[model samples]
Structure formats: C-alpha cells, structure tokens
Target: MIVNQFLVLGALLFSIGVYGVLVRRNAVLVLLSIELMLAAVNINLVAFGAFVDDAAAAGQVFALFVITVAAAEVGIGLAIVVLIFRNRSSANVDELDLMKW
Candidate 1:
C-alpha cells in the first residue's frame, strides 16, 4: 500500500518533470525540470530504503549519490546557462541554434 503510493508519487513527479522539460523553452526551466526528475528519483530511492528495513543500505547510498550528482549538475548547468545568457542576451534554448555546427 505505502509502496504503491510512493511509486505513484514518483511516477507523477517524473511525468510532470518530463512535461515541463518538453514544454518550456527557457534553459533555466529545463534545468528546473531536470531537478524535479532527480527529486522524484530520490523520493523513490528513500521510500524503498525505508520500506525494506534490511541490513542493506544500498538504496540510501544510491540516493545520496544521486543528490551529489544533481548538485554538481545544477552547478555546471547554471554556469553554462549564465555564460550563454551573457553572450546571447537571453536564456531561451531556441536561441542556441548557433552552436549547431
């Protein structure tokens, strides 16, 4: 029952993140969507770790790794976005076609 609820919540959040990424043209919004997706993944991991109270803490460890990766991604992504904004005068992804070479 609780596991099902957690799965449902994770699924919903993932779907929302996907939708946001697909519908938004701003790079920042896309980054935010990615963060949402990562959050959903973390929720699933933590929930599973809590549900199965075994001696294995692999799920929790994986969640911590995911968090670390997400933080690094956000940092790098923001830096790139800022650079693009400074050069292009806007943060819209549609304007990034100049780099298609």
Candidate 2:
C-alpha cells in the first residue's frame, strides 16, 4: 500500500476525532474522541516509519509509547468523569464547574 493512503486515512480519522471532540457534550465521548485522534497519530507514525525503512523501528516504538500514554489518559479521564458524574449526576462537559472557585 502507498504511504499516501495511510496519510489520507490518518487525516480523515483525525478530522472526525476533532469534530467529535468539538461537538460532543458528553465527557466520555470527548475522551473517546481524544483516543480516536491518538489512533490517527499512531497510524501516521507507523506509515512514516515504514516509508523511512528505519532499522530501529522508531515509529512503532513511538506508537507504542503513545498507546501507553493514551491508556493512562483514559484511565485517569474516565476516573474523573465517573467522579464528576457521581457528584453531579451528569456527564455533560458544559456542566462541569469543578475548577471554578
């Protein structure tokens, strides 16, 4: 497959993710959108790594790191979302004011 194909796919996924993040009101949906964006980035990384023919497989390694960080993000994000829902009974991002003094 051509690298351009992967690039286009990545761009499409990233665009969708961005739209979801911007339009979705639910915190869970926002987190999922963020994950989608990360997946697009991973796709691009692997594609570029293959195109470069790097011996170190740096692209795959970086993709792995991104995955790890994403997992941690999801864990923490969900935890906070759950806590907010428990306290507020709503998961709407617009309704959250925990940071407000």
Candidate 3:
C-alpha cells in the first residue's frame, strides 16, 4: 500500500483519460474521458490525504466536493449532448458548430 503506487496508478489513469479526450470524436466518449480524469484526481487526493494524516480529512472532503461537481457536470454535459444529437443526428465533436454565427 505504498503511496507511490497510488500516485502511479493515478498518473496512468489521467494519461489515458487525456489521450481519450484528445483522440475521441464522440461527445459521449469525451465526457467519459473527463470522468476518468476526475476519478484519477480523486485517487490522488485520497492517497495524499492518507499520507498527510490530516485530522480534518481535507483530502477526502475535497474529493467528495469534486465528485459532487463531476456529477453535476455529467448531468449538464449529457443534456447538452443529447440536445445536440437530437438536432444534428450526430455526436461528433468536430461537426458541432452551434456556437458559430
């Protein structure tokens, strides 16, 4: 249960998430990648919190806050994606031009 092991695992997960975000063309896949990245962050936070031996459990608390925010983000993101898909019939990120005038 070495802290380094946890750190390495988090780093690996984050790297994979980044790759997925950069290479994937689907909006849903992008959101999944973002969730993966958030999970990696949570892993690191808990690992550090345990390592620091903080009395207030700040790391876990912050991780909880991140989880809450991530959930909200997924809700909003999926809603937007669904709307776009319904309108455009495709969820490809590169094809989206809703912001263009």
For every model shown, what is its TM-score relative to the native structure? 0.91, 0.93, 0.93
The lowest-lDDT stretch of 10 consecutive residues in candidate 2 is: 92-101
True lDDT of residue 44, candidate 2:
99
- Candidate lDDT scores, in order, read 0.93, 0.96, 0.97
- Across 1-101, the per-residue lDDT of candidate 2 in tens digits comes to 57999999999999999999999999999999999999999999999999998799999999999999999999999999999899999999998765887
Using lDDT as the yardstick, the better of models 2 and 3 is: 3
RMSD of candidates 1 onward, in order: 1.6, 1.7, 1.7
Q: Is candidate 1 or candidate 2 better by lDDT?
A: 2
Where model 3 places Cα greater than 4 Å from the true spot, the runs are: 97-101
lDDT of 1 by residue, 1-101 (tens): 37989989999999999999999999999999999999999989988988886687877988999999999999999999999999988999988786675
Please give the lDDT score at residue 13 for candidate 2: 100
Top lDDT model: 3
Error of 2 at 4 (Å): 0.3
- Which stretches of candidate 1 lie above 4 Å from their native place? 99-101
Clashes of 3: 0
Cα deviation of 65, candidate 2, in Å: 0.8
